[model samples]
Target chain A: MRVSELVACTGVPLATVKYYLREGLLMPGEATSATQARYGEEHVRRLGLVKALAGAGLPIPRIRKVLQLIDHPDGSLFEVLGQAIGQLPPYLDIPADPGDYPRARAVLEKLGQIYDPRYVAVAQLERALEALEDAGIPMTEERLDAYGRHIRGIAEVDIGLMPTGSAEDAVRCAVLGTAIYEPVIAAMRRLAHQDIAQNFFQKTDEQDAS
Target chain B: MRVSELVACTGVPLATVKYYLREGLLMPGEATSATQARYGEEHVRRLGLVKALAGAGLPIPRIRKVLQLIDHPDGSLFEVLGQAIGQLPPYLDIPADPGDYPRARAVLEKLGQIYDPRYVAVAQLERALEALEDAGIPMTEERLDAYGRHIRGIAEVDIGLMPTGSAEDAVRCAVLGTAIYEPVIAAMRRLAHQDIAQNFFQKTDEQDAS
Candidate 1:
């Protein structure tokens, strides 16, 4: 397909398509003539994935990295994805140092102490730690397990929306799942605070009435 | 406090803080001296909110709009939030034309017909419609209800980890919840697909044994 046809099919503007090509986000099609380039189905699929990643709020550079992983599909995509989702600290870059892992581990341990009675397992903790290590930040195995347990409790609630399947599906679901659920969790936390305030007020009112 | 102080207190880079001011995402503090702008606690709070919104994947312009709503805090914030969250297709953002309302309603209704019996309530549909309408999308009440039910079913399992509160909290939670949960859900879905494939081979082996 010509650039115009590609643009129409993808619902992207011609200028934007050109911009993407210039930015190296889109590969050039075969040069059919001095003025024409012929694109194929690969371009269509790649374009769609690019758009999806962009919509998911990745920057052009990061999207490029993700696209590279998609092209390779050598399990690196999962690693990149795990890093993207698990290490997200309310939207900032993950800490650069493995040394910071201890502090992160502490936070996870504290959370585990709060929720451990709910039945999160040691193996789940190991899996989460492995995921973190795979993503390039190595924490103590013990810390990772504790963190995993806490996250698992929270994740289990979130995972119910997902269809049941294998560990790999679980990993992929974890990626997309975190993308959509973080905002919801934040909102819920705010709501919880509001509820606490309401309960406090109600208790005060009851005492005054008495 | 001067811009430096604001930067120090907020833990934001001076350049980023300046960018926020230039983008109108952060309002300037009082100018105490010719060269120094003195910021106060309000600036710190506003900056935190700005950071949070930015982290939530809103662009600077969109964050500015949301800040405007926060500044006003009358009837507009609800509308702004509605617009922001309701833009997600199929999940929110019902079309405006009255003719489209029925189709929206039908879609929701069909979803409700299919999924409501399992986990969601009729009331959720009502709330969904109200939210859509409040956001200026003008979805039919019936349609809104239908979407609510569909979403509720997905949300029900996840609600275990969520903090339940009043309707206001529900809206806030829904937006943030969706943001965090989407990625996790995607990961789970992928895991499920992988599991199915693995299980298929396992089942084949089992059938041979039988």
Candidate 2:
């Protein structure tokens, strides 16, 4: 397939395809001519995957690393997953309040899950605390633990959706579901809020209406 | 308090505080003297909220819109929540495949959710479908509807966590939770993936290990 065919099939923009090509984010296709390149199935597949990852909110550099992992002969599923977690933008790494760490530890301890402050769960707890603290939205340990328990169920749903094929397939499912489906979760929550907001906020208003 | 004191109190960098002031993101405190300002509690609070929203991956313009909604008198909690949803960065507005929109509609129809094609859920589901399709990951409508049902429960947990106070408080909680705690949700899911990856992916790998 030509570059245009790749774009048509993948639905990625022509300029973006070229950008990926120029940046070496997408490997150059077979050279049909000095000025032209002929893309094939791999290019189309890579193009779609890149678009999906970028849509998942991975930066170009991180996306590149993910693609590299996918391309490498010896890239384990675990390695690709680690890259996905480790390459998160710095904002997610908010420093927790001194008290929250111990509280998170206790929550982990009580839940029978291993506690590592450095783990993603702990980092998430820290950021949640930091944001809550900064906004003056007080969060108690009970509330935090409740969130942990609830989010674990959410995670189970996400993991359950993934295919249990080869390691490559598992990694792809994990990456896309984590990134793309996240908005699906968030968007649904917002919709759910809209669905429920009346009762929560308009109780007195409801009384007046009745 | 002074600007330096604001930095210490909010843990935001001095330069960032100045940038916010220049960008009109942070309303400056009283002008006590040339090159000096007396930032009070409002500045500190706004600074913290800004940091949290940014952490939630809202771009500056969207953050500004969110703050504007928070600040506007008569900004009902509903309006603020709407702003948070409507002003999502373009990346989340991922274009769906030609066939995926109709497929998403079918999924929603079968699930008994009478959502518009223009609705965020439909759009999100379309992207989810597109991502899966592009990568050749098989997804059945039954699977997608199953996800929707489970995700509604997740949304309930999120909404339940919200305070049923005045509109202002609701908006604040919504913004903070949607922004800051979202990472908490995402992070927990990732951590959960790691927790489950053993059983999901490593069953065969474990056999190899033995």
Candidate 3:
């Protein structure tokens, strides 16, 4: 298939395909002649995987590293996924001046997840707490514990889905799911909040009217 | 405090303060003369909120809308949050072609949450399912239901946290948490996967070695 066919079939733009060629993310097709090349099924499959991973929010350079792993015959599937996910930019990049690490550590311990404060996840959680405090919201011990319980539920679901596939096949699934599910889940949460808030607010309005 | 003082006090750069001023996301300080403006406590609070929300991934225009709500006394607290969250760009914006709404609706029905297909949340769910199918992964009803269970847990945490304050006070909390928590939660899930994958892979290695 021609490069244009590749684009038309994959629904990716021509410039992006060219950019991928330049970045060495997608190898050049069979050179039919000067200025023309024929792509194949292999190129099509690779392009699909690349698009899915990129869509999930992985940076181009990191996506390169992941593609390298996917190409390696002996690459551990989980390792590929770990690299894909582990490279995610930290949740919050705030400085340590006013952050309460002791509290964050305590919360992590209470939740049974032992991670260093430097772990991006822990740092991210600390930033959330700090932002809440800065905004005058409390992070009482009881509240943190309750929040932890729910996070554990979400984690279990993510982990549970892991055993469902062989490593190579599952990498794309995880890559896309990681990129996709959060927005879906978060949106659902927002809609759910809207439902609850409407109920509560409606009752308040009625009381006020009375 | 003068404009410089506002910068000094908030720790945000002078250019950012000026940019926010230009964007109208931040109200100008009390002007004693041309090129001289004195900020106050209100400026400090608003600047902090703006920085936190922007850090969370809310765009400038969306931040402007949120700020407008925060300044309006009669703005419903949930409404303020609805806009803040409602403005979140969907994870994937693929055209609705080939997306299985019937499957998505079934998943939602199984989860006991009936939402319209046009709802951003429902549409986001549809996109995720489409990505999974495109990747050749099974979207079994049971798996989605299990995923839903976890999402329900996370949403419960979010809704529980809502009663912490009146709407305005909670807006900053939600803004930061919304901007911050998903990344954090997603990272935690990744970390958890690494842990489990390590265990599974290690056992396999032992079996091979033996």
Candidate 4:
């Protein structure tokens, strides 16, 4: 397919397709002529994946890293998953010493999860807990464990959704599933708050009116 | 307390605190002299909230909107909560016609939640579902409900944490809790994925070695 056909098939703009090519996000097409090239099925599929990752709110550089993982499977799904999590953004500034995040460590210990100090999410979790504490909303062990139990269920659903086709499929599923479904999950939590609050506060408003 | 004391107390730097004042994210301190001003405990509290929201990755505009809701309450908790949800970011590009988002509507309807078209989260949920569909990982009603159930539990925890002191306190808790705790929840989800994946995948690796 020509570039025009690729754009039509994928619904990506011509300029964006060009941008992806220049940024090395999309693979180059076959050289049909000096000024022309033909894209194949792989190009079309790759464009779709790129669009999905972008829509998942990943920056271009991180998307490129995820694509690198997908393109070359190290055959260790665990390592690939770690590398993918490391790519998720908002990497916080960690302290020079690991001992500063006692709240984060304590919560992880309470849950019996191994606290790999190098994992980006652990550091992020620690930072968030610190901010929450500073904001005067400390997370009790019970609260953190409650979140852990519920989130563990959600994670099982996440792992169940993993494709068994190939290592490539597994990596694609993990990366996309993690990034994309997060906002959906967060939105659901907000909506649930609205629902429960309406049931409680709205009813109180009505009762007061009566 | 002086501006420097406020900074020392809150740990927000002078320039950044001044920037917040300039941006109207923080209120002006009472002018005590031509060059100096006095801040109070309220300023200290507000700065903490601002830092928490910023740490939650909310931008200036959204944080300002949340502060407005907090600073002035009309005594309607439901209304304040609705306005708070409207400020969450990544408000997606919606279609011209509402009928295009059948998937989002269907999922909401199946869950028996009232679908207010004005709600921003609903639209974001629709866009995410559409992207997932386009990416060939369309959300089944079952999958969405699974997420909905778990998130609903988390939301119960959120509402349980609501401070009942003043309308201001409630708004502060709602906005700050929603924004700040989301990343923690997301990080926990990722951590749960790692834990569960280690259990399944790592055990498989060991078994193969054996």
Candidate 5:
């Protein structure tokens, strides 16, 4: 397929495709002649993933990082998983030392999960815990464990969706699934809160009035 | 206390607090003299919530909407809850007709939850489901139910942290808790993914090799 065919097949605009090519987001095509190059089926698939990530509001550089993980799966499983999820949004500023978050470590330990201090999600979780605590709602290990247990259930679903294909396919599935399914999870949680409050909180108010 | 005392108590900068005042995100203090006004404990608390929301990367307009929800809880429970979560970040351009998302409604029905079509989260979940399906990962009713069930567990924890105080305090707790605890839930999901990938996926690979 020529570049024009790639654009037509993927429905990406011509100039945008050119921008991706220029930015090295899209892999170069095989040179067919002095004036033209040909894209392949793999290029079409990669372009779709890139389009999804960009549509999900990921910056180009982060999309590049995710592509790097998909393109190269030679890293250790844990390292690759960490690097992939580190691409998720809301990047935060962390302190120099991870030791500043003993509570986060304690919570992770309670869940029987061990992580390197420098793991991006660990640092993010630590900061989230701090914010919750500062607002006078301390996150207990019991609560954290409960949240983790339920989250593990959802993670199982996430992993279940991975295609049984090449390493690149698996990486692509995991990263895109994480990025995409998260809003679903968050939205579901909010809906659940609304349902619970309506049922429980309102009932409590009536009982108190009685 | 005066505005300066409120600043000292909350540790928010004078300029930022003044900005919140000018933006009407914080309530005005009672005028005590020609030169100054007296802020009460409520102002201090409201200032803290404003600061937290702003630091959480919410824009000023969204912050104001959240503050309005906190201030006025006289709306129907469903409406208020919908409005509050509607204030959450990453607001998307939802279609005018919620009926466009029959799949989202189906999943909601599967969970035994009913939401007004116009709810923001419903529209968001609809778009998310479309994205997942477009990626060739169709979200089945069973999967959405499973996700919702686990998310309900997390929501139970979220509602548990509500302070037993004024309606204003409860709203503040719910809104801020939702905002702040989301990152914790997200990070936990990622950490769980890494742990499961390490223990489960690797073992599966070794078994295949064997």
Candidate 6:
């Protein structure tokens, strides 16, 4: 396909595609003529993936790096993704020690004792700690388990919606769901005072009516 | 507080703050001394809000405009937010008749019939149509209701972790979550394929045992 066809198929404008090309974000297609370049299936797939990553709030340079990793497949994509998203803080590394698991479990158990059962289930908590450990983050087992359980519990109770599926689906859903909902969560937080104020006035009005 | 204090409080370097001032993204604090300017509570609040907005994916110029609206309070913050986030599409301006509520309800009911109960219920589709009308987006009741229901259903199901309470918090969590989780989700998706392949191998092993 030519540039026009690419744009039509991708729903991206010609100018925007050109901008991406010029920015070195999109690789150049094979040259067909003096004024034309022909793109193929790889270009289409790459463009779609690029759009998805961009929509998910990745910076252009980071998206380029992610694409490079996907193309190579040398190491696990998990490590590449962790680096791309800046999730692995500078001090941390991946593939945590098995010895840390017991401590992490203890922390989660402590968190469970503090919060409601629905907030953080034992199973999900364990998986999250495992994931963090597998990613080689330098959390003490206790801290990892505690933080994992706390965040998970807060997330579950607060979201007011749940996914029904297998353990794998639960993990996948949690990963994707949190990604999209973060903005909505932020917007809601900004409006927190208003929500409280409105609830207060409504309560007063109800008391007067009663 | 002086620029140094502001820098310390915000964890932003002085040069970055100076860049913000030059870009007109931050306002000058009260001039207390020839060489020192005193920043007050307002600066702190505004800077914090600016940082939050920037983190939530708004560009500097758009964040500036949102801050201007908050400073003035002439219009609703909801409107400012809608504009800042580009949530209100341009096509929502087509006019509709005054008595369109019934038509809207019918469309919503039809959507409720087709989509999953959990998705439809979480969307609060009926209420959103009324909100669209209230916001003066100018759609037919049916159109408004249908679109509102559809998007809400998708968002509700797609957003995995709920931070609970406050729109701003939701948006912030969504942004950060997206930033952190996009690559994670991609990794999980790959892992899912691996799981499938593993399952297939296991089944083969079981057959051989049999």
Q: Which candidate is the best by DockQ?
A: 4
Q: Candidate 1: which stretches are off by over 4 Å? A: A73-78, A83-91, A96-107, A110-210, B1-210
Which model is ahead, 4 or 6, in terms of lDDT? 4
Q: Deviation in angstroms for B61 in model 5?
A: 3.2
Clash count per candidate: 41, 0, 0, 0, 0, 38
lDDT of 6 by residue, B168-187 (tens): 44443433332233222223
Task: Kindly list the per-residue Cα lDDT of model 2 for residues B1-210, writing each as its tens digit.
Answer: 998899998889989988988888899799999888898877877888788777667788887887777777345565567565555543445334535477566655665553434445557656666666665664666555555666566666667777776555666677676555555566666666666664655675878899
lDDT of 3 by residue, A96-150 (tens): 5434565556556666664434445556656556655655554666655655565
The global C-alpha lDDT for each of the candidates, from Candidate 1 onward, is 0.47, 0.66, 0.66, 0.81, 0.79, 0.45
Point out the worst 10-residue segment of candidate 1 chain B by lDDT: B115-124
Q: Please, what are the lDDT tens digits per residue for candidate 2 over residues A134-192?
A: 66665656555665666677667667766666555666676676666565556555555
Ranked by TM-score, the better of candidates 3 and 6 is 3
lDDT, candidate 2, equals: 0.66
Q: Which residue runs does candidate 4 get wrong by more than 4 Å? A: A32-36, A59-61, A92-101, A206-210, B18-37, B57-64, B92-100, B206-210
Query: Best candidate per lDDT, number?
Result: 4
Q: Which stretches of candidate 5 lie over 4 Å from their true place?
A: A93-96, A201-210, B93-95, B201-210
Model 2 chain A poorest 10 in a row by lDDT: A89-98
Error at B42, model 3, angstroms: 2.7
Better of 3 and 5 by TM-score: 5
lDDT of 4 by residue, B1-210 (tens): 999899899999999999999999988999999999999988999998888777766889988888888777554777877887577676665445657778767777777776455677777778778778888788876687788888888888888878877877887788778877887888888878888888888678888999
List of clashing residue pairs for candidate 2: none
Q: Write out the backbone clash pairs for model 5.
A: none
TM-score of chain B of each: 0.54, 0.78, 0.83, 0.87, 0.84, 0.47
What interface Cα RMSD is found for model 4? 1.4
Superposed by TM-score, candidate 6 places the C-alpha of residue B153 at a distance from the truth, in angstroms, of 8.4
